[model samples]
Target: MDSLTHLTNNIPWQRLTTAYGRGTDIPQLIETGQYEELSSLIEHQSTLWQTTPWVLMILLQELSKQKPEQVSLQEIQLYTAVASTINVDEMDSQHAVETMNELLDEKYLWPEDEEDDELWWEEEEPRGYDQEAFSSYFSYSYLLLKDAIPVFTAIMEENDKLAPAIQELLLMLQSEGERAVE
Candidate 1:
């Protein structure tokens, strides 16, 4: 438990498997591909907003840079379409999450009583995804991965203290992501 918390405090996503492996010795589950628990564990621990999202984004960015030949078609489209739309360079996770909600999920507070022809609007407000805090959260994640995703990857892969091979597939995907070029 304490070890998991320590691993959670560090981000880039690659370290999760190692953290798990260290605690549990069942590396075969990774080989068998029963990794849903791994994902669930991550999400469960991340209710407070984890930097794994940035790890994902970094992998995407790296993928976009690398093997353009093998990049996911969606990645290409997203990079082409939303790259310019989003101010990623200046985007803080808080603002980004909030903006994401605003642009994607607009919330409308509805009145109790409904009218046939006449419409009643009670309140329309932005469901802020608590944007002020995650800004620094993402910034910290960026700093963690600035060196290379593999820095964390190596740590996870080699750390016998962690479940070592837990996120084997995700690490594989992220490793494949290194194909991006400058």
Candidate 2:
């Protein structure tokens, strides 16, 4: 059997849990062409578990090997779900602002007056989630599946439903690329 088939069949679903329930149902969900169910399982609110990215990588690899004309809506939805989970647009703006602020600080330049600085610092809340783990997963997933991007892009171009998610994925890829080059 192919690697993708092996992966889907062999994932330790009983020990794994998604936003909903046991992950064992995931392979069946994909096999049965249950896009919505798969989407819900892979993306739970603002949390993308480590397992979700692994599943997504396998799905993308499977889809990428297929002819462009043969790609299914369920597959595209998989891409959309993965893109939504990453939520790169939200991260992009926030990261840009933070990076800009850091650069200014390093150069001894302040964008705001002393009072504004104090107010902003006071308002800055501690992140309640593990941002590092999320970032690491996102970077690793993108790098692992970068080769499949063009396939996703083609799907996005032909289907309006995929545009938003594909766009976010592209933005994340671009941002990651820039960071790599720097």
TM-score of each: 0.24, 0.58
Predicted model with the maximum lDDT = 2
Those runs of model 1 whose alpha carbons end farther than 4 Å from true positions after fitting are: 1-88, 91-129, 150-181
Itemize residue pairs with steric clashes in candidate 2. none
Q: Model 2, residue 124: what's the lDDT?
A: 41
Q: What is the lDDT of residue 122 in candidate 2?
A: 50
Scanning candidate 2 in windows of ten residues, the lowest lDDT window is 99-108
lDDT of 2: 0.56
Per-residue lDDT over 51-81 for candidate 1, one digit per residue giving the tens place of the 0 to 100 score: 2333334443444344323333333222222
Best by TM-score: 2
Local distance difference test, per candidate?
0.32, 0.56
